[model samples]
Target: LAEKSNSVVDNDSKRKIKDKGCIPGLPIDGLPVYTGKEVAEHQDPDKSVWIIFKAGVYDVTDFIQIHPGGRELLLGAGNSVEPFWKVYSQHHNQQVYRILESYRIGNLREEDRLKEDRTQDEMESLEFIPERDPLLLVHHEKPFNAETPANLLIQNYHTPNNIFFVRNHLSVPKVEEEDYSLEIEGIGLDRTYEFTLEEIKTLFPKHTVTSVIQCGGNRRNDLNKVEMVKGISWQLGAIGNTRWTGARLVDVLRYCNADLEHPEIKHVQFEGLDLDAKSEPYGASVSSVKAFDPLAEFLLAYEMNDEELPADHGYPIRLIAPGIVGARNVKWLAKIILADHESQSHWQQNDYKSFPSNKKQASPEEFAQAHAIQEMPIQSAICLPEDDQIVQIKWKRIDDQTKPFLDVAGYAWSGGGRSVIRVDVSIDGGKTWFDTELEQETPTKRSTTTFSWTLWKSEIPLDFNQLRNTGNQIEVICRAIDSSYNMQPARNEEIWNFRGLLNNSWHRINIKVV
Candidate 1:
């Protein structure tokens, strides 16, 4: 044999090693030690697929089809798997190790092994600030998902970029303005178009839309109270209203000669710059009808609240699909694909879906049957006097006797371009309700759509002596009515779902009167 060679295998030497006789798991006199360059040559799945795991080479060509995470997520088919496996720690188990052992082919040369070790060390040293707002409650760190507290969310009509709720699916990508480019492609387009930051800014007239972007799972904690549901246990602050300024998506589509009238085009997929370990970008799709609709009020926003978009909010650009669920208003937008089908991304296909209340577990069949959440339902929440809080009420003379009166303030919103016309507040758990004064920021004349949220406040009168005699605690509930006359459901149990999406139930809070 080759005298137990420890040196790296060149292209010609690797071919020679492959020709030499060897058996699986058997002791060979001169087992091949492949160089990193040699390993990269087998990346194409149609030819051969190789991956290095802890200095061990494995031919995972057949295993690709059986990989639980799917074949596309195999991560660098012919490169070291250490960096990716570090991000996806699920593969660190003994079961996955044994499975990899079955596909062992050879070992990485000592020189390449050392290089991979150094690369992994560099990757481990990278740090990301997964959070920005101290008041926002964090749900996950790596993906950097957080929600604003109800009290802080209603402090202003336009939520500040710093404290705005963030719902990222991956680490916030660092994008430089000079290097940024927005791509437009796919089957529905006559030709593809690429625009730099400056080109996009000057190419079209800047349009502004004041709108609300709400998470599909807003108020999910209420649903969780009725029954355990899967999702970030967002209390009530997963929604925000902001003024977004950018070029119209329709105008951009026209500039690119997109075949919007094409009958085959069903969805417009948006891909973000943020990527996962597999290098797959975060993506979601909106209906082409909405994308092309002149009155839909969609925008490719470069500015939020008249300021440049913050890094956490798609610094260079983002899709602002007003009146739609926030998930469809994709951030860090880099590519717009006019496709015949919806985006096959995990967020579009599996998550942000509404399931039947009876569905206890998330299954393939349930996911397949459920439709992705688009527009939200009528929703409102009490921001001040938090649940289980003690409120010192001021005494007021009512019928010549002392009675407690306090101001209750909160926000109310609806989806599908509907405005919140009325918000009813009840201090006795829906037994009696009083209408609150609704205030909405004036919409831009260009935007005929009503997409912004309304801040509602009401001063409630309480009988102090009657409450003191019965109990100190009282339940306060609020429900909203949309312009379409649609009202929030009376209870969470009635509208609970497996994914905890669209929980537009009456918001209730219990406060101790002092």
Candidate 2:
């Protein structure tokens, strides 16, 4: 027709290039180039949707509805998708990158390309994901929040790293281990101290601490059963036991020349590399007392289950504040501060706090007054039968009496190093109770307590008459007592809060007892 391009389009070359996620023939350079100004003009839905990933420009107008992130994909409509990808770490995979490449229309103009990308290689590196266990019960995918399945959770006293529960508030950071460093500073320190990953490994002695890391909202779903609450509907699987191997925090602080005894030093705040929209890293803090206490067993853990820490669980470095709620055990740790007061971060001041039942609205003044959740409450959960699972009644000797029974098993543990002492089961819904055989080891260290979880199993007598009265259905409820005899409440109504945190009420499940 009018004019044919000078460069001939090789059909085989085009097919191979297309398979590698690139255009065919535009000016014979393979793709058209557009400036940032041209791309910015397509923000309106009526025009088209253009987004940039690294130096590549993609037209995702047709892929909008099919995006796994749903409508949130529109967040990157007319700008760089880096911000969205930072919050949604799930997109950092080769498969996702290939899918994104399918919509590539052109390249960003070199003049308009990011200064940081111009000098880099054409290909972008993706993060490694080794903990994509199929057994995990995923609750959210954006930031990758998942829990261990109940049936698999109680099978091992020490949880496997691959199957361990993962809780992330922001995107999991992709930190290069070779360039990793920890910065320690604040008012309590004589001066700031920075340690490279190698220096930390060589400087401090490796200490193994067996502990249980549990989310404060471990049983938030139970509280939701009472009324509606605001948070991830986590079941009992939001906890796991692990043998963390790392350097003691007290030792690290001392090496940094921090004045542990300084009266002004009251809190130890931690910040992670994962950031939010404002580029602020995830932050939290714990009391200086717990940070320095020998019994507290604080650690700068780099290994989980005697292996290198998983990426989702905090690869290079993470805090292991035993007995404290998981929220305070910040992952992908970047900085630590010793100060006179607690961290002023959003998580510490507003989010992880629990409010009373009478408090209806989440007001700023009220959140400021409310204390942050540090040590988690005592908790236990049924693992064997599972909720809504059909269990067959078998004849067994329970409490030395031969009767129809259901084999029950679960896990229990308490915060502040409080060992789980006893577990009680009730088939009649708290009308009566039976003791369970607890499988736990006594603490060996003089100054330390058992920070690990307690595994308990029991056989509960099932009443056929009671099943008939309840329409062939029965409820299994359980509660645990800590070393201090702290027992869980019988009902979730007793501990219901607006945020639905610390739901340590009786762990219950309904099953068909036929």
lDDT of each: 0.79, 0.80
lDDT by residue for model 1 over 360-423, one digit each (tens)?
5555555656688888788899998899899888777868887678778999988888888899
lDDT of 2 by residue, 372-468 (tens): 8988878899999998988888897658987897899999999999989899999886889999999896798585478999999998767777788
Model 2: colliding residue pairs? none
Q: Which ten residues in a row have the lowest lDDT in candidate 2?
A: 1-10
TM per prediction: 0.77, 0.76
Clashing pairs for predicted structure model 1, backbone only? none
Where does the lowest 10-residue lDDT sum fall in candidate 1?
A: 20-29
* Best TM-score among the predictions, by candidate number: 1
Off by over 4 Å in 1: 1-124, 127-131, 397-402, 443-448
Highest lDDT, which number?
A: 2
User: Candidate 1, residue 253: CA error in Å?
Assistant: 0.9
